[model samples]
Target: MYLVGLTGGIASGKSTVSSMLRELGCPIVDADVVARKVVEPRTLAHSRIVFHFGHEILLENGEIDRQKLGRIVFADAEKRKLLNSITHPEIHKEMLKQIIYYFLRGFRYIVLDVPLLFETRKLTHFLNHTVVVYCDPATQLSRLMLRDALTQEEAEQRLAAQMPLNEKRGLASHVIENSASREDTHRQVLRLHTKLEDSMDFLLVRVLAVAATAGLGGVLLYAAKMIFS
Candidate 1:
């Protein structure tokens, strides 16, 4: 199985790439979705967070007030670290479980879409290849402002919180430049899909060749033993 790690800064079009991969039949394990699931009401993460940050972060309906928690944590490094400490492990565990499920089900290629691939540095061990979707700072700011309704400064602050786009591009095994139209991005994704499929075919051939060679060697050894006997 081939595991690809997909990462990019906020509003950098990673979601679009993920969607394209899904449409193309690649199984995806989304970290953000897993993160939310891990912190759902009545979960251990939810309980730990409530205990540490007080009940004020909970709504009257007994669910987490994500906005309130975001306000408290995003602006404070310590609080953000505390939140990550509570959530990251659970998220990682769930992601790994999903990855293993897909792998065992015979998926040749799977994409692990994560926002903080570089920051967490867990991609190195889990991913066979890493793809980073990237755009210029101006394009990122514009898209983020329109999508999230944030001011330029606010968007920039959020962008700054993660690694720079250039750095992510440098670290990635493949970079999808998304500073163009949706059609352009789709073309890039399709190209990437082709490349990944070709690589998978090559890997499969190599594995089959090795197995065949081993089997032939074993058969020859058995024949030699019979003759000697």
Candidate 2:
């Protein structure tokens, strides 16, 4: 199956579009979900995080207090990078597992919902299609403020932390504008789903798998013929 990378600004409704795609039976590998899983109390990443950042970041129950860690990292780029260095490998491993699971199940394509799809640029080359769910800057800032109950300044700081949506829009193969009504957004998602399903891209992986198996079979047959002769 082909891979699709989906991303947007913090409050640009990327998750909403992801949900719509899910309703259409598309498989999704969400980075945010995997990120949370990699840092569970007993995970290796969790131990490393606590060791570096200290137990102060943990809650009374010993789970990492994400908010506390977020505050520390977001305020310092070095700390953020350190946190990523610890968690990213585990996150990638888990995401790869999920992708393989979906691929084996014979999905047409799987959506990878990554907030930093543009920022990280790690998986961009592997994606057959990349989508950016976009909204205007003012709308994004306002939406973030409302959703997170943050002051205008706080929301702006959060927005500035990531690459701008406009830049990501230019980099994407498709753009779904979420600035308008939910109906409009849903229509765009429906069209996108149809487009992805109709593409022949998914056949590439299947063809490669079949060719590899056939090649191995040929090798085995040649060895048997030599032995018999």
Q: Highest TM-score among the candidates is held by which one?
A: 2
Q: Give a tens-digit lDDT track for model 1, residues 1-229.
A: 6678899999999999899999999999999889889898989999999999999998898888887887678678898889989998888778777865885587778898999999978556646789999999999999999998878877777777788999999999999999989999999999999888878443753474466587765764454344222
Any runs in candidate 2 off by more than 4 Å, and if so which? 215-229
Task: Please report how far candidate 1 places residue 137 from its true position, in Å.
Answer: 0.3
lDDT of 2 by residue, 98-171 (tens): 87799779898999999998897878877999999999999999998898788898787778888999899999
Pairs of residues clashing in candidate 1: none
Worst 10 residues of 1 by lDDT: 220-229
Q: Score candidate 1 by TM-score against the native.
A: 0.85
Evaluate all candidate structures by whole-model CA lDDT and list the values in order.
0.84, 0.89
What is the alpha-carbon RMSD of candidate 1 to the true structure? Answer: 8.9
How well does each candidate superpose onto the true structure, as a TM-score?
0.85, 0.91
